[model samples]
Target: MEQLARLEDLPQTYIDHLTQSNLVPLWPSLRNVLPPKQPVPLTKATAWHYRDIKPLLLEAGELTPIEKAERRVLVLANPGHGLENMKATSSIYLGMQLLLPNEWAPSHRHTPNAVRLVVEGKGAFTTVEGQKCIMEHGDLILTPSGLWHEHGHDGDEPVIWLDVLDLPLVYYMEASYVEGGDVQQVQGTDLGHHYAKGVVPTVHFVRQNANFPLLRYAWTDTKNVLDALAADANHQAPAQVSFINPETGQDCQNIIGYSAIRVAPNETVQLTRRSAAQIFHVIEGQLSITVNSDHFDLARSDTACASCFAQIDLINRSEQPAYVFVADEAPLQKKLGLYSTRPRSV
Candidate 1:
């Protein structure tokens, strides 16, 4: 090859001439540097989402002492998304969060994919798609991605959760539209009672003997399913088990990516990095997570544990077990309908 060189011996004139001819054309133009072109403001009212807390997580002693009663978040997208310059979807993604004791974000929803996870709150709620669900902590509540949903505090304490929407997704598609519900919110108690009254109730899906598939999952029932897995001889999962729609047997929440949980509990889970970058949020307990030796001490509402295709280890130090929510494309893209665990190739 050509001899190795250093800049010290090069003449100033030669360096200047070389840089001008080689670099200026690569500089971004004024148009590229300017902000995105603002389209004509739509006449329809645009809704808003909030992330500031009624009380900071560091404020209260009890909330911070045991690390309970606080709303901590890893992601929040509204009014903007991280990759705004790359895509143009009207959908906006939000990671709404709340902690305990009187910190209610109030009732509101718009024509966007609004989804929430009851991170660590009891008696929190969302009335959506004309149905109501009491969001117990760890419950994945869906507002039909675009139906009317509102969050509130009815119990004695505060509740916090993550609210994710697809506004940016829509913005990229350039097919975003907005329309408000005729009624801002429906009564939660009424919806709750209406569902409870029916015996062997089946509203969304018909109940077959083995495949009564309407509800994606109930945490208690899933726990039992996991218990069965534990009883099995080969329960390593090396991969994780995902929730599937029983009727169609497809993954739930089409655009939300795929949701899966790993029960390694102080073990290592290998993953391959690809185009799909995920934001993993811890749902319960504490963990010592290391993404290739870049360690993260994560607990409930603490979102320090995330990586894309790096070898990750979760070490639990708490007396109780830990649960984590990982978002990634189903069946690793490289494997195509399968989870992949291979080392990165240089």
Candidate 2:
């Protein structure tokens, strides 16, 4: 009778404390405090929902506040391991970054795939998979999952780029692993020695020589590919290039996926109908993006998004030429027939 009364009274105290504090109170019988019921662990697996990033729109001929902010490479998200602001499982994780002159971010590596889209400035380089690639303005450099890479600014001006990774999935799986690079940098400053010297030969998966795994994509010849695609009438998608396995011509990674973005001067592109949420970083010039009805101006180092394909529209305002980096999980979402975009009424 005493135990039964205590059980009823103990719950009453817990409930009273919960209502008063608006938080879950611990029971003396438990080893640790219990979290709120809303965040309780699920018995069966549940599908995670997509989240959108609010966009920051920039004006024509205007620079982002980061210029005056006087810092290099602002981190958009780094909320611990499991609590990262962006999801890495169901979709790709994209981050906006700006690096001023003379700044160097140390070398590091992790399990998720990553890429950098140079937004502005020059003289910044990322060494990936042993290859050093000068992250020129408008260049896209990829760091494959489990590759060691680092960023350094040796240029005269600040360099900004978007950091996209498959962080959410790794975080959710709780398989997060990280490590520092083997050295400060390779012996050479150029970003070519890692693979050109035959030290790193292509790995073979089958007799077909298919699916060559590579980690770097330099901008030196990428622009030419964009030009060729622009000249081809059959190719309508902007920057519609896929990261292929160098050996097999297969995708570099599976699941969390890819995007193609190349903006013309003062051009605004409308997406067709996409369902996977995407994060966009303004690579060059200034951009005004309208998702559904709301809009935001984004300059270099600024980010915007269309949550799970909630209707996306983009307009470039810079004069010199503009580029944008878009990250999405279309590879997975499209497989489920959930990736598409409808033009929102202007």
Candidate 3:
């Protein structure tokens, strides 16, 4: 690669004139925008253990009431992007949100799309687009852009869920904002279970008001499918299942992709590099993961981030089957015509 000129090489007088007109030359930073092989990534391989976060999250509960702290959450910010940015990757925003017993998070709609992965506790439910979708352990729920969603807890213990949003990208585009509203009456229950594997209701796949058909994906159903897929493959490397809209058979949401993987006991699987950044949250058993050079021993409820084109290896250390929830930027990348993956045998 040819050496690019540094900004300091430019004459001070020329720099001053360009500064006056708010114009900056790109030659000096050209390589940064267009690297030799792959694009430089600000997302880092990072981990957020639930063990460490639970205490602090509980403290937040004691520190303030739900009214004062709208979404009581501790953002899982990637250091490479600066912690203040509250981004897990360039387009993904992650946070550990807490909803104490009897507490309610008011109804509000935002321009950015979001999803909630149930981490701990239950009896918490999210009412999205007038449907009350119950939040259970390992369940996946979506709050699509421009949809009113609110959370409430009816369980005796506190409930915590991992919040993943396309906030960074939306905020960057200057289209991020929220509008509050009164509680919505439950128009219907979770419609996810209404449609089974390879089956869609002819009566009405979804209610008329629902633009994004399915809202809640039960872990039970997902686990059953994962186990079936793995067993059918005779406990092959690793089994994966994606969450998608039952109607269109596309990703559950357009901005981000959600999936779950089941790694057989004591089995190891290597996932080839991809252009999209990825996140892993262990839902069951323990996981030993290697992203590039960084390695993480993830226990249940532990979350980790990996940069773009990151070589990933997942090893189930426990005797029991290990299940992990995965989120990635593939959908958005594919939409932008930048999605790429290179497979490598282990």
Candidate 4:
């Protein structure tokens, strides 16, 4: 009788109602699921040394061909997150791909926007929708969502580049799709030949398709732009330039943001914390980036990543100017009304 009375005292009506409706009340789990504040940031400040990864990349190249491997890429997986997911940060995916001379990475297109920042070698080209854009060290190339593209290397040395993609966003939205193209390599005539002849083959493609107006942001032009910006005597901490869509004059991709930041010799730039995560690749000289309270010194060809909502500061300790290629998830965050930044105290 005592046990029966205890059981009767329990909220049997509420339990029966919840089970019939297939709904679980939040009262018990609310504290665990919805906290007063963000439990913790999803990413960590991490850096990768090219010297350490180069040999491993080379070994991967020897072990598998481009076709077998699909793409010879070594992902810069974040320690905070595990490698099984292949993410550099919670919002961005970063990888280093190597293409040997005379090799080809087959044609395929996906719904996620991607950008490549060339790190080493030259004479490689990525053909997007029949327009070939030559790849050189320090160049930034774009392959927007659903754009057919293929990569091939004709240079004497192996060409390597950092591949940044909005894969996490696509995955989160469940909009990821990949379709392979029929052609393996761009046919007989190298489009690069036309480029060498001072002809822009992309003009016709750009006119035909308004979606992909730009394919390649050449390093020479980018350097010139940076130089022009730096020429101003009152130029500020980090001289920066963004890659924009030729048609919209907006970010290169609708979902991703790309920029080049130049830090003059012996200069330190204190950057505010933002709600979007960013991955940066060091192009030249030496740089020390302080994220939150942690510091990372990046050398030439090194890469570093910062988590969302963390204050960052960049310092150039070398005699020569330092350049960094940055890719971030700001565009999507801004579009969704989730973008924010707080100024850091000097």
Candidate 5:
């Protein structure tokens, strides 16, 4: 009764009633829970080196067969979330997957949308709804939510790729679902037929449909477009381009966005902050990125994450040009009217 009287002078009967109803008065905790400013648990900018993890991935491949493992991926867990969760940032998940020669990852689908940026090797391919798309170094491939896809390697060497997904968003929404395909192996390899027929067939088997018409964004074509843009004298920051849907001319998916940035030797690109967080992977050469006060020096096959609303700058410090692949959730943020950017003075 005395403690109840001291708790903001609430009556003993009232306090007892609140406890019996499994409810606590909010006045005591309101200030801590609802502060004046939006409080976000900021994730620090971090980097991962492919060279350091390559051996462990190779060893895992030798020890565990693809048949038993289902998918052989090593997640790049964020330090902010601790090792329990596989998220690379608050809203994104990043991983490195390895597929040895003649091995295959069985077909399956999930609610989270994913994008694959090839890091090394070649002759590996992913099949989306029976359409096979070849995977090579620097290629970008999309695996939209709930799409039946499988991976296989026919090359002599093991193939490795960076996998970026909007899984945290799916988990947050409580919309996660997974289903395994009936067929274990991909049957179609009609790459020439897709062009010869002049019609790309859609996957009719899955319940959830994909917004983008195309799945494969070949590195050769992407590089050619970037090269043409760089040839212009007006081109600044070397070049920057987004992978868009051929039919819609928007981002490939509504949940995620993919972009490529190139920087010439000894050049720096200044960019303002935006509401969407970004993760950058260095494809070639040496690069430096400063996100607000945090600085990251990245080499080939390294990755860095910049939090939302952090002013960022990218610099190519090597003699050769640098290529970077970026993944973000700007599309979703824009759809929700939560995306904003402010220009920074150079």
Candidate 6:
């Protein structure tokens, strides 16, 4: 391997001439962009504990009312990305959003696809497009791109949900923007029941829906699926299921891929390192997460993030099985032909 030239070694007059012409050399900074073996990711192995965050999040609610704060949230910022950037990974934006009793986050839609993994409380619901999706302890709700959505809480307790969005990628492409709208009159019940077993209504005229037909994925149903997968006597593979569009069978969203993974008691599952940055949020029992060399002991509502090509291992050292909700940038990377595992052979 040869050493690359440094920008500081360049002649001052040449630098000034290039700067004046709005041009610069790539050789001096080539490795910064195209590194030796793997990507030099700004994202690092990071974890956000729910215990430390709940108090601050509640304080945010008391300090700022719903009217003043459209969405009361505390961003889970990764230090590698810089706290100011508010990014959990290279492409994902994570925030713990709160909606107090009788409070409503006004109706608005944005260009970036967003999903909410319900963390606590029950009386909160998010209306996306026209369906009213009730928020439960572990429900996964979608508010895809360009869709009208609003959050409202009917119960007395404070409701909090982890919001996952592709804001950084959309904002980078200059396509991220939001539009405010009047309060939504939630039209129908969530579409989850209709496709409960992946069965489309045949006798009745199925309501024609837009790109997103089913928005709410109940955790009970997802956990059941994972249990069934684990019970299989045929294979010993990782018990995981991808969240997909019921209609077209594609990824639930265009940019990010979401999944639910179950680790049986006293098991250690090595999640393969891929070309997409990933996040894992604990939904059930405890998990000991390892991202490369860093280890994170996660409880309910705790989250861990790993950059691309970083080794991740999830361990369930307890007596009960552990369930995790996962999100990654694979959809976008695959679409752009930049997704892959680390090469095994040199």
Off by over 4 Å in 3: 203-206, 234-236, 343-346
Ranking by lDDT: 6, 3, 5, 4, 2, 1
Stretches of candidate 4 exceeding 4 Å from the true structure: 1-39, 184-206
In candidate 1 the C-alpha lDDT for residue 156 amounts to 70
Error of 1 at 193 (Å): 13
Candidate scoring better on lDDT of 1 and 6: 6
lDDT scores of the candidates, listed in order:
0.48, 0.56, 0.91, 0.81, 0.81, 0.91
Q: lDDT of candidate 4? A: 0.81
Q: What is the overall TM-score of model 4 with all chains considered together?
A: 0.86
Steric clashes per prediction: 26, 31, 0, 0, 0, 0
- Predicted candidate 1 versus true structure: per-residue lDDT over 195-284, tens digit per residue: 221233465633222231232234554445554664577776543455554444555555545454545455445555443435456666
TM-score of each: 0.60, 0.61, 0.97, 0.86, 0.85, 0.96
True-structure lDDT of candidate 5? 0.81
On lDDT, who's better, 1 or 5?
5
Which has the higher TM-score value, candidate number 2 or candidate number 3? Answer: 3
Q: Between candidates 2 and 3, which one is better according to lDDT?
A: 3
What are the per-residue Cα lDDT tens digits for candidate 3 across 1-346?
A: 9998998999999999999999999999899899898888988899999999999999999999999988999999999999998899999999999999999999999999999999999799999988899999999999999889999988899999999999999999999999999988988898876788788878544475545778889999899999899879465556998898787788988889999999999899888799989999999999899988899999999999999888899988778999999999999899999999976535
